[model samples]
Target: MKKFKCGVCANTVYFENFRCLNCGHALGFHPGRLEMAALAPGRDKRLREARRGPSSPMVYCANEAHGVCNWIVTSHPDSGFCDACVLNRTIPNLADPQNVRAWGDFERAKKRLIYSLLRFGLPLDGAPAGKGPLTFDFINDAVTGHLDGVITIAVGEADSVERERQRQAMDETYRSLLGHLRHESGHYYWMLLIEDTGRIDEFRHLFGDEREDYGAALERHHVQGPPPDWSLRHVSAYASSHPWEDWAETWAHYLHMVDAIDTSVAHRIEPRSTRFFSGTARAIRGQDAYRSNSFSTLIERWVPLTLALNDINRSMGHSDFYPFVIPEIAVAKLGFVHRLIRESTT
Candidate 1:
């Protein structure tokens, strides 16, 4: 979510930009460096870099041919997709124009999730022998969207109308393509790091025992909804359904908060408090979120940003961008996620 610019003209650009808006130079993401590079012609169809350190020979991922990916392969000499794209088990049908657009949105959101995970040095093993990697299935079918080892994203979820309808039906404050990807991936990582590893006891103590009957719990949740005082612990109403849901929902919000601070850092969006310790708001700076070990700095940045954004949204007669509150219990859960991710990096 950091700011990107063209290496050729220094013009502001977005992560999804294929070519510089001002310079018209082709662009590709260098995953190794965690930066974007402007592209120049090279041998065959290969390209020579122009940014993010010295210019080097590189080629776009094969998915670029279909306009779905912007990442480049950094190691292999032969042309291929980047490490993130290689996990693709099933992509949407590209022949249809609407499917192609929906697939593009899905890829963009997926890449954002992968990018953040990689920035934290999380392991992303390649697609396994036959089963698949932490793969994705962007399907247009009757199957419910979920993750049972492989992440599934319904193509209709990409449509703004359909997404909004579903969000309203579920009475969620926030929902998006990125949110779905992050939440589902949370389930995948929970099994990988918590269940398979030895963090089960700690996880259970914080999020509750996952041994709870998921089907019945969910059934009760949908029928009765979350308790009125659910915010005292769970991040969302859906999170109150079960221990597994609590972990995934909390994990997704952790991603949301961190990513938001990252963008705030990249843009130098810092908020300063005027009063001393007697005041309510905490002081926060853009750089603190990325550098500080404690969640205090990140939460300090998050609270004010949410406040400002929510007020601005009201001016435009729209719903709050982040309508949820983070009480002490939710903060404790987020701190656990923070420690786990940082520990993995070390």
Candidate 2:
């Protein structure tokens, strides 16, 4: 996530900032401009343009009434929810106080994921006949998260303590609401970009055979554990369970690296040009990750960024923020994601 600033006060703010601390101005994220703007109150606390120009007034999404979102609807006032929230197929019954709080927690991570997706300029139109449109369902579930036509997230994942416990129970080095959303969405996109398009053969070549028996493979994985030295290529041990899983896991990791690297770029946290961290570091310099034609350079820069952040995380006595490595083969898979995303958008 890139750091945001309050346009009114020129003070550091956040994407989820509800009010500017210094200026005490109301804040809302404008998706069209991809900015967090300080609102000048209009009639009845409605938002006036913070930008110094002729402008039309804006209002927060309907979900803001519940304090569940802070995104502004830049379109018609009757649009109700922002683009992101509209994809929600089912939300927990907010009548229960626990469900209300859990739903709030879920929205924060969901918005962040959507922000990254929009910035990448990928497809967000969703699907017709329940086949294409990406939707999410937050409810009571036995699973942490799962994706079919809709992604279902267990409300318990909203609690950090509970989520961490689940992570440890599953032996995951990293897991979070955002991670769950990104990972599951990978499956949805796979259905759209690969399965529906008849490109599974190419996908199989890169990841492995998705046609392999998934349930039996998962049984073997849990019984015997990941192949020794799974990290040599797979993004996570769970990825070794099946090809479909590997693709989803890799796709999730791809989003993770890019988002962090995008943050580095936003904060101007580039490496010293005089010193190259690795052989490809020089090759990666100056590429706009959001618009770059090549994912090769993107991954090259992401490696050093991930390492630096991981070291910093250790210094703070926290686990590595990003706990996986992209070996040569893994990079090849990520490159396929890059090309696939480009293909989808264009």
Highest TM-score, which number?
1
Candidate 1 per-residue lDDT over residues 1-346, each given as its tens digit: 7899888899999988889989889998988998888998887877997644555678888989889898889754453768778777787767899999988988999999998887777767523322224777888973534565688888999999998998999888889999988898888777666765577888988999899898999999999999898989988999999988888888899888888878876887655643324566555544635445876667666777788778889999998979898878888888888888877668
Clashing pairs in model 2, backbone N/Cα/C closer than 3 A: 126-133, 127-132, 127-133
Predicted candidate 2 versus true structure: per-residue lDDT over 1-346, tens digit per residue:
7778888889999887788999888888998888887888777767786766866777888888888898888753566888788889889887888888899889999998888888887666546424657788998864655556688898889888999998898888888998999999898888777885767877988899888998999999988989998888788899888998899898998888788777788788855322234433242355567677877667667767777888899999998878886677888898888888888777
lDDT of 2 at 104: 89
* TM-score between candidate 2 and the true structure: 0.90
Lowest summed lDDT over 10 consecutive residues: which window, candidate 2?
A: 272-281
Residue pairs with backbone overlap in model 1:
127-133
TM-score of each: 0.91, 0.90
How close to the true structure is residue 138 of candidate 1, measured as C-alpha lDDT? 84
